[model samples]
Target: MQHYRDDFPILGREVYHRPLVYLDNAATTQKPRCVVEAMTAQYYETNANVHRGVHFLSQRATDLHEGAREAVRRFINARSTAEIVFTRGTTESLNLVASSFGEGFLKAGDEVILSTMEHHSNIVPWQLLRERKGIVLKVIPMDDRGVLDLDAYRALFTDRTRLVSCCHVSNVLGTINPVAEMARIAHDAGAYFLVDGAQSVPHFPVDVQALNCDFLVFSGHKIYGPTGIGVLYGKEALLDKMPPYQGGGEMIARVTFERTTYERLPFKFEAGTPDYVGTHGLAAALDYVSAIGMERIAAHEDDLTRHCMERLSCEIEGIRLFGEAPAKTSVVAFNVGHLHPMDLGTLLDRLGIAIRTGHHCAQPLMARCGVEGMARASFALYNTREEVDTFVDALRRVVRMF
Candidate 1:
């Protein structure tokens, strides 16, 4: 962990006279030096609007930008680069599918299934579709342990069930949903399956084809890449059938006074100027993670997470932990007795410890657990056991205060 910690220069900074302890990884990860350097290199070396210009710099920029798309395709193991579309982030990617796929295939009274553990990005888009298209939004029930009830999910699918959208890994609960099984079930019901991979992609390996999902979306920043860059991977056929998400220069084939046609596959959905530099930085981040190996990262984080839970449970009194599923990522969400999460978070910040405290954008999940909010500490591969120990010692101070 120390070897890779150098890659993230910000990790060395001080907060409130104490070492900065970054536990808000579920929100967004700090960028590695390679990722930032890549962005700088792109801006200095090949800064030009992609696909619009035919000059030397433009062609070079276009190649670099499109090459990033290929990197994304390979990262997710998609069939072709044509299946990948770049967006501002996961929110925009999910919105693209909700708007375009809904208009093309979904009808009035159709059903789109979701889970209680979903981030707001997964929930709101379908709700928008419901308001505009009269579609029914059904939620898959989850147990108190923060795991989804597959029996309830199977029951929710009827003839009207046109799509099933769910998270691969929950941002709040850290529950790793069984997307492969869910995709199989959706396919059996003749429904397309979409996965919000914002949390999962950062933690472990996720092959889009292996999951057998129709669409998958993830943000680059969550995976140590630059912000404002994300990937939306739909099956080529599905993306082709769906209409353009937005309209502008690159998405158009040839504009005529009478009729206009959209560009093919990826560009059809990507309207206006694309984030070429960010995409290049994202590719660099992907390369960095690949060099580290997801399996090794996953194993290291698991040990840290287990240590964190043990320390929090054993060292602290009257604390309640949320999302205790057997299968989960390196996220800890909990609260001490009668202490407001915001207050706890503030105290922790004063101690130079950073953790997220709130409903975690899943109000329904918080409601399900009979709480307003919980403080969360999410671990990344670069995190260390020593840091976890320091965090626990600081938490002890927080408890003593209350």
Candidate 2:
């Protein structure tokens, strides 16, 4: 982890005349030098519109663009590149599914099941679909420990159930839900499963085939790549039957005043000029993590999370930690002795320790936890135990001020 820290140039900078300790990985990760350089090289050498022209620059740019698609396909172990559809980010990806799939398959009375702990990106899409398609939304409940109840999830299914969308890992809490088993249950009840992988992809390996999910969406920025680029992966058969999410230049085969034909597979969903440079950078980020190996990275972050939890529990009096599931990841949410999370977070920022303070886009989960918002510390592979110690010490100092 120490050696990998050098690859990210932003980590060396100081904030407020103090060394910066970044723990807000759930929001977005710091980019590595290779990712930045990869995007820079593509823009400098092969800056051209892709998939339209036969000129040398267009051909080169198109190849790099499609090559990134293949890289994403391999990274998630998808069956083929045909299933990968690029979008702006996870929010757009979820909206794409809600619009296209709802228009194509969901009837007026169809139901989509979601979990209590899901981020708003996953929950709001279906709510929008409900408005348009008259679909009913069902929720799978979780316990105080932030673990979803599998038996209750099983009971949420019915004949009208059309889809089950859930977070692979909670962005607010660190709960790693059992998506594979949830997918199986959804399949048994004749419902398509979609996993929101925005929080999980950067932490552990996600095999689309093994999960057997009909759709999986993640953002590149969360995985150490640039923003404005993300992936929506659907089973080939499902995507083949669904309507195009948006219609425009690249996603069209032929256009007529009366009728227009859409493109096939991924391009059908990708409506505008794709982010070719961002794709290259995302591929480089994926390559960087793959070289380090997901298993090794997961182990390192697991140790860091344990250390963070232990120190925060021991050093800080009147501290309350959230999300204590048996299977959890590298996030800790907490508050201390009637002190507002923003106060603690603001004081920590002054000390040059960065962490997130808010409902974290999971307002429903915040309500369930009996709080308005909580301070969050999310760890990544590049984060170290020394940083964790510093963060804990800073929190202790902030607590004393209150």
Candidate 3:
């Protein structure tokens, strides 16, 4: 309900002699001042490695670092900090699960079910496991509207299906998947479920327990935090059963030439020096968003999404909008006439409008949609209806030239 236009300093910046209209939020959000200041303050005050030294600075830094872990646990409503493992980003988090979970639970003949709309992060890790461990990967089909074919998805699972992993919201389509039902379907088939919450986390309230997913991953940068930090949430029993993703000094309890033992719970998966400053930034970002409230943010974004869609549809003739699902988030994927997405995007940039154009790292989804690429204008809490007006007008200008 509140307008936070000034919270982000980057919005004041001009591009190509025009006011900046930043709509490429699905790629990465612009950081708030609080997030930037928090990371800066952490380095200036508490700059020491966690769980390593015994001195005052180390103890103080460790507390701040561990406090961040608790903040992330509370952000997603996770059961405990033990279930949250920090990684570089969503990609690394998914890779950790693929490498550790694959080694522990998957065998030669096991199957993993994924959706066609998954980002490359979710797809590549499983493909790597297939190549390394001989695991079979099946894709859940989606319709032209970018909605997943749920009936077909259910049929893809067999007794060999060891895991069912899908995105909570499609980064390209913006279709919010029915993950709770899908999780139940996987459970009925005796399979564990994982949800990629990268696109969903910043915009809405997400409860890992309510979804009944064994694992969930999301990136902090997408949620207005600093880059190179992500959270991986796994059920305690499952994470405890899986092996460590990488072996290093911090993750170890004892080291010997004969044998070495690993640390417990969260630390076991987080090897080497953790990003303490970035963790602080993430916590600050969560606090910033929470102050505004997720429900309010989601509602504002939904209104903006519909407004942008209506303007584009009514003003621009022959504008083909992708992802027309009844239930969707704030992304609008469209290609105007025969104008190539890249050409349209380049011209729009000259007008000081930023929009993502291409396959959006989901080549499979692009192929399924029967397009080489598309121009995506995604909204965030800080984005505005005025910026949306500027974007649509600029898009019209770009289309006229081509």
User: What Cα-based lDDT does every candidate model obtain?
Assistant: 0.92, 0.93, 0.93
Clashes in each model (backbone N, CA, C under 3 Å)?
0, 0, 0
Which candidate do you rate higher for lDDT, 1 or 2?
2
lDDT of 3 by residue, 3-85 (tens): 58888999899999999999999999999998998899889988988888999989998888899899999988899999999
Candidates sorted by lDDT, best first: 2, 3, 1
- Model 3, global lDDT: 0.93
Which residue pairs does candidate 1 place in steric collision? none
TM-scores for all candidates: the values are 0.99, 0.99, 0.99
Tens digits of per-residue lDDT, candidate 2, 1-402, equal 799999999999999999999999999999999999999998899999999989999999999899999999999999999999999999999999999999999989999999999899998888988888799999999999999999998988889999999999999889999999999999999999999999999999999999999999999999999999999999999999999888788899999999999998889998888999999889999999999999998999889988998898888999999999999988999989899999999999999999999899999999999999999999988999899999998888888876
Clashing pairs in model 3?
none
